[model samples]
Target chain A: MTQARLMDGTALARRIVEETAKRAADITERTGTAPCLATVLVGEDPASVTYVRMKRNRCRTAGITSRHVPLPADTTTEQLVGTLRELSADPGVHGILLQHPMGPHIDERAAFEAIAPEKDVDGVTFASFATMSFGLPGFVSCTPGGIMRLLDEYGVDPAGRRAVVVGRSAILGKPAGMLLLARDATVTYCHSRTTDLSAAVREADIVVAAVGRPRLIRGQDVKPGAVVIDAGYSPGNVGDVDFDSAVKRASLITPVPGGVGPMTIATLLEQTVDAAARQLGV
Target chain B: MTQARLMDGTALARRIVEETAKRAADITERTGTAPCLATVLVGEDPASVTYVRMKRNRCRTAGITSRHVPLPADTTTEQLVGTLRELSADPGVHGILLQHPMGPHIDERAAFEAIAPEKDVDGVTFASFATMSFGLPGFVSCTPGGIMRLLDEYGVDPAGRRAVVVGRSAILGKPAGMLLLARDATVTYCHSRTTDLSAAVREADIVVAAVGRPRLIRGQDVKPGAVVIDAGYSPGNVGDVDFDSAVKRASLITPVPGGVGPMTIATLLEQTVDAAARQLGV
Candidate 1:
């Protein structure tokens, strides 16, 4: 049995970070101000804390300034909105990332909308979603943007291809399917409520597993010669796809930790520089 | 062979218009001014002119006022945008409809954006699309809103259903698929570049034909007991689906002239009253 080639998101992310760092330095030199990203965390959930730290570290490594706003767990929707709007209006902040999974009481959409469209480098606003769905020029959700960069890096043309996105989340599966569709792929979105999950996956020329259910996609369900992307990150470092089995049947695959994960932060850093350039008129 | 039951869009549309007229009357009684819809037609295209006239007549029949703005064929994008913005700002104009298929010179998206989101009763704005896709409460594209009403009227639950939308037009097939997806249908979008259109159609439990191609979906491609909706209207009054053949196998189908066409205008009138209600705070 032929094993699939692994799509190395780690190496590509590094390359992107290097390029982004150079752009950031150039902007700092000419504009007399460094590109800055303001990250807002509603509460200190352990995983959320770790994720924010990683992003902030990446920002520092990429020559961008990171501003952290740690809100109390009891913060109300109005308070969160005010804080986000403040960051949005801050001229020194080039980009804004509001780390989500904020408490149940939080109106996530309202908080996301508070981030100005221009400084919304994390790409979570309705304006960004509209642009992404319509294939218009605008900032895209980081994970989906990273996924597209991976597809381009591997020379995978989505035109006339059958791509099944096995999730319907706002940032991941939805935008991933949209980006693929924008490239002329026949995109199918399968969710938890899908009647025949295996049947849908079996028909895919490319499969994107983004539902956060570990091992939801089995190796036997994968079509031979298909490109398999596991954007799902479940507990215990597991992905949505059963990697061992899928590798035997697929042409290309992304391992969770080393694949889609790194690309997300990379894309955020790259877009931060882009947003800075636009705002700086450089 | 069990012939499919026809979904009577004309009858349903009449019912909707009657209800809309009552709402329009209520608004007119409470407020001194009747709700007004501004129909902007840019060019002398026969189809565009016919569509505008239909909308205007529907407005008058529903006891709403109609304002016409006919621009020249050579109207520039900036000029059309300015005119739309003026209508948007007009307190008397509750809804704005820019009859599309405007000549090649006009930038359609730019013109659509000029209409304020609150007054975008036609639901062509990016704001409307984002809300529609996100399943948020907002005015939907008229054709899509009409289709959803039909689905609800017929008690067709989209949950766990396989829906194939055989087009990707921004306002029609795209919004249709998103609407179905919001209802928990596993939606697959097939378009001109789709490699296996027949295979895709055969797998659908619900098929929405909105590609603007006459008789593109054939009987052999439809699964027995499928629900077929023909939203496409080409010249010669033919629909996208081969209705005669598809009806022999499908459980439900929409015909060309009497189906999907009348619903479009009905939806527009209904939404116009809705916009007026919101504006009048009644």
Candidate 2:
């Protein structure tokens, strides 16, 4: 089988990060203030911890200052909200990044809502989601934002195309569909509530598998010459798509480790710099 | 050929208006205040004038008060913004409807932005569009809102379904896709920019045609047993989808005059009442 062209997300992400670093340095040198990103994390899930550390390390490398706020696993919703609200009101903090999957007990949405819309660099707030979905100028969820960049880089124009997104998570599926719809692509969303999966996947010129089910999407189900993006993250780093099967049918496909993952951090850093520039008026 | 079952929008509209009128009267009597809608029109396009007049007349029939603001054709963007801002800040104006098709010279987005997000009853603002797209609690664009209501009334569950929306007008296509996406339907948006419209249409379990083209979608393009909504409008009551051919394939179909048209007015009135309640804190 002829292999599909793999989208080099890592390379693109590196370029984006480098550009962000330069901008950060410029902003710092000109204004005597570095872009500041507040990283909020609740509970120390090993993966979440690693992700937070990686983000901070990346921030330091990009010349952006990082403010770490590690809350206890038993942090009350009020405590988290107060902390976020304080960060939101602080002039020193231009952007706030609240790591996801805080804890089962935490009111995730409520805590997210506490971060001011202007400082919501993580793009998790209702206001940001709405703006992103409407195609209005606003911060976007990192992974979904990265996905669009990949599509654009690959010369996959969404205008008047059929894009089927398999997932319905609030942060992922819904926003992804909204983003594509904004670009004039016909977008469809499937989820646990959906009765049929394969039939839906078969009809797409563009398929975005974000449901986090490992190998839920198979190659045979993909139409010839279609573009496939697997944003799902599994324990072994397996994507939602059956890469072995999908590559044969897909004209362009995103591989898990090399594709979408890298773009998330890139987008985050870029937004941090943007927020800083706007707030500092530099 | 079997005659298509015409979905009667007129009758449906009458019932909805009647229900809205009763609720409006009850709310007014209880609170010593009636629902109030603010209508802002720039320049006197004959069609726009007629539409605003019709909406105002309906508001009166429902016992809702109407506030009308008329601007000359040469009104500058700042002047228009100033006028809209006054209406937005007024506590008595529960809902604001900015009559569309403003003069070419006008900054439409700027004007729409003047209306507070809460009073954007017409759902034209970026905030409203974003909120609608996110499936969050916010006012919806009238036609798309009506379409979803009709779908629910007809028991068309969008979850896990392939929904193709043919058109990408800001108020219609974009918002419709977001609404469908929120309901978990995989929605694809197709428009003039689309390369292959037929293939996209054929895959839809639910199709919404909002392009103002008359009879553009043929019956052969529709999937059998799909729910079809024709939201297109022309001078002489023409629809976007070719009704005659589409009916043969669609399990349920909304007729042009009797389907989506009535729902727009209904949704408008419903939102006006809702706005009144919220503003009045009742």
True-structure RMSD, every candidate: 1.5, 2.7
> What lDDT does the true structure give each of the candidates?
0.93, 0.87
Which 10-residue window in model 1 chain B sums to the lowest lDDT? B42-51
Q: What tens-digit string does per-residue lDDT give for candidate 1 at B59-79?
A: 899999999999999999999
**Fnat of candidates, each listed:** 0.88, 0.64
Give the DockQ (2 decimals) of all models. 0.86, 0.44
lDDT of 1 by residue, A172-242 (tens): 88888888999999999999999999999999999999999999999999999999999999888899999
Instruction: List model 2 lDDT by residue over B186-257, tens digit each.
Output: 667788877788988998899899999999899999888888899999878889988878998888899877
